[model samples]
Target: MRSLTEEEIISHIPELSNVTLRKITKGYSFDLKYVTEWNGKNVLLRLYDLDLSERVQEKVEKMEAFKKLGVRCQDVYAFGEVPEENFCYTIFSFLEGEDGEAALANLTTEEQCAAGYEAGLDLNHMHELRIEASMKEHMAFIQEKFEKAVERYSRLDQQIPYGRKIIDYVRNNIRLIGESRLVFAHHDFHAGNLIISQKKYAGVIDFNRCGVNTAYSEFDKLELFSSRLSIAFSKGVIQGYFNNRVPELFWKIRSVHMAQLLIYHMNWVTDYFPKDLPQAKDAIQYVWEMYEGFHRTIPKWYEERQA
Candidate 1:
């Protein structure tokens, strides 16, 4: 797709008539994103193909809902289709800060934990917007998803080591999915989507993957991303979300969630991002070691930190 010039953008969205566009090239999202200034403040403009109109609307609604609940996130300034360009767009108040994954290394362990705690608290707040699905319905959906993931993994030419063990673990603990509350989830919550300003979490970004699911399913990314960046921060997120009282059931559910990801996400990377397959494998290995091949529930990083 051709890039949209500033002139073309201003012609369609008159409110941004004087804004200069600078494309953001950091993430894996297929959306065309640009950073610009509007009304004397920095803003982000995300352009999605017209076919994804529904997703854009849903993203805007979710962002508005998160804002109303006091979650630190982008505020939608404007959103609509740019029909002439065959794409739709949303302009948001830009978050000013460094990426949390990159910034956490500069912070003290305590400081990292504090930022994670705040992020966890914000995530907990977002979950307040519960979806009306019953536990039975949620369980059925999870079981179907698990079965599909297992099928896909089975068909893959390249499979991770100990794939059978992971599948067995998920099957054994699948019942725990029924115990979870259905809530709005960020879906991709992790240090990579977080923003850090002056060693504190500024806000979260990239709500494109938001949806409804079992609440504890949200933490799978903590194993894949956050803990690799800062164990203290990952631990803090859990502490903040659960009010410093982590539950045994949480560990059980989290392990099951991680097991599913081992199959599902790896298949995803294989199909859509083959180059990332090695990194994905390493991440899977790390998870296996962290949980000791599902022999344990709580990861050693969280447990040793408490000790």
Candidate 2:
């Protein structure tokens, strides 16, 4: 679909007909974000082609759940399909602050860690908001997913670092993957989607990848992205989430999840973000470097600090 003009957007959503609208171009979520005023109040409008009613419903349901749980996120105002324009739009309050990536650049390492710690607590709360369907159901799901990932990754052509070691490690540690209690994972918890205000965490954004899974899976991505930001931040998140008593079991499973990502991440980047190939490569290298440490589960950065 061709990009809709501001007039077209206003026509579809009458509330925005009289307010100012400026396009938000920060992230790559195909949805169009317009920072605009409505009824003498500023809000962000996210408009995307309405493909499936179920998809839109799921997103709004999760957003609503997050808001109720006291997780710092946008308060969704309205969501419905624009029949004439074939678009679905959701209007929500705009979080007033710089994105965490830019904000972290100006913050001290300790401050960044504080931001990460706050974000981590929020994530733990999100996971606590909902429980998994059933132990049997999740067991079956995790088994099938693990078998498929290993079978496919073992056959794939790309040569990632420690390929055999990771595969063997995954196969040997198969039981650990599904042992952790399942909860709703924000799947993409990182600095990029966070909002920083007054050198502190304001809120989190973008729950598009949210799902029901093991909570530890969230750390896999954070460890990758936070490595580029600050090791202290990454360590702080772990400490804060587990209340400064990090569990050995969490680390064991986190290592497995990160290993699985090495095999599967390329396909993700190729399909959704081809432009991010270089960054993806760097992330993969970072994973390899982390695994190089003597303690297989604990990341190298955290291990270095403890030493």
Note the clash tally of each candidate: 0, 0
The local distance difference test score of model 1 is 0.87
Q: Which consecutive 10 residues in model 1 have the weakest lDDT in total?
A: 298-307
Query: Candidate 1, residues 22-91: lDDT per residue as tens digits?
Result: 9889877888888988889999988888888897898799889889999999999999887778888899
Total backbone collisions, model 1? 0
Candidate 1 segments whose C-alpha is farther than 4 A from its true place: 1-6
TM-score of 2: 0.90
Q: What is the C-alpha lDDT of each candidate?
A: 0.87, 0.77
Give candidates' CA RMSD values in order.
Answer: 1.8, 2.6
Query: Cα deviation in Å at residue 105, candidate 1?
Result: 0.4
Model 2 lDDT per residue over 1-307, tens place: 4577788778778666766689988876777888998767789888777785567667778878988887888888888788777788888888999887788888887788898888878877787675537767876777687667667656645556566676677667757877787887777888788899999989988876777877788887777786667776777777878878887888888888887777677656756787887888888888888777214777787876521
On the 0 to 100 scale, the lDDT of residue 294 in model 2 is: 19
Runs in model 2 with CA error above 4 Å? Answer: 146-158, 293-295, 305-307
